[model samples]
Target: MSVTPITTANLLARQLKNLINSGSLKDGDRLIERDLASQFSVSRIPMREAIRQLEQEGLVKVYRNRGAVVKTLDASDIDEIYQLRALLEGEAIFQSMNYMDTETMARAELVHRLLGSASEPTQQGLYNREFHELLYRRCKNHRLLEMINGLREQIERYELFQRRLLSDTLKFQDEHEQILIACQHNNPAAARENTVSHILSAGEILKSYLLSR
Candidate 1:
């Protein structure tokens, strides 16, 4: 039996990602590499690497001589991110249809069930991503998955806000059900359409809410 080794940078990245997603690292929060290194009890190299990875994911901005700051999304940025999500995720579901087996469908069903029962918006968001990832991951395109996950991460804060501010988590779960059912029935066209609609609808709601803020 072999276990994959977790690199220091990977560990640091995961920790930082959690902080960002949980709103511990608010938008525009400065991230000092030396301070983070000392806080995490790791060397500066891994800390810098983790910050660089987050920057690549659009979660961090590196400023000359000012270290890194958490990235802030404006209305247009949110619109573009969600639009790209709708496009890429719809395509991912379309391409994954042929590769989705009965077992994978079953797994997606289980994730959907869990998502449906999640009580909190934050937890629901986690299960929601899991369910969608299960459906789309079989696209067999690493680059596409990377892009999708990046967009997903970029929307985490807004998702949490939406979930808490609205009573529409159940509505979102219903759409997830529709997508999963389409996948189970081997209807890629329906799944693709539902996936795109689901993303765009959520984006509109979030965009309106954000603009009102």
Candidate 2:
């Protein structure tokens, strides 16, 4: 689903995001517009748009005359992203506890089950993305969503990277299920703490991966 055969930038961006998120086009990887366009059977224009989207998300950097390259995030980047997510998404999750309907909650639980049952880490990663997106859908804060989306983008590779390296996704699943249960209880404090702990745990795992790299 992330790898689209189309040439449009939106599709290209989505597919490229998925690649970056899934650890295919890893940190510091150069993304050639021509090669990507050729691979996707599209034109340069859409590929450029796709690059721009990644640029906005802080996943890719563009130079004056050169093409784009995936960012090799350092400690500062992770720190900033985690701090930002703490302020914005922590609130979002707290607000979401009050706003979520039973159907939506059930859907999120379904995502949890799906993530647990996924055959591979890649599928589990995708499920993780969807699960979080669903959790914050009721926040009613467009700017907050945008910010969290970028933060999530910044950490995607680390998530997949750590899981593959450690071969341990069950821990993540356990944490998420706990967070979801907190939401189910309609307890804002519990949801916020659980969410913060979840993000912090991810930061620690990702920190290990970054240090290893």
What's the lDDT for all of these models? 0.86, 0.81
TM-score of 2: 0.76
Candidate 1 runs further than 4 Å off? 1-7, 165-169
TM value for model 1 = 0.84
Candidate with best lDDT: 1
**Candidate 1 lDDT tens digits, 94-189:** 999979888888888997888666678777767777888889978988899888988888878667877664345467877887898899789999
Q: Which candidate is the best by TM-score?
A: 1
Give a tens-digit lDDT track for model 2, residues 115-155: 77776867776788788878888887788888887777677
lDDT for predicted candidate 1 compared with the true structure: 0.86
Task: Tell me how far candidate 2 lies from the true structure as C-alpha RMSD in angstroms.
Answer: 4.7
Tell me each candidate's RMSD, in Å, in order. 2.9, 4.7
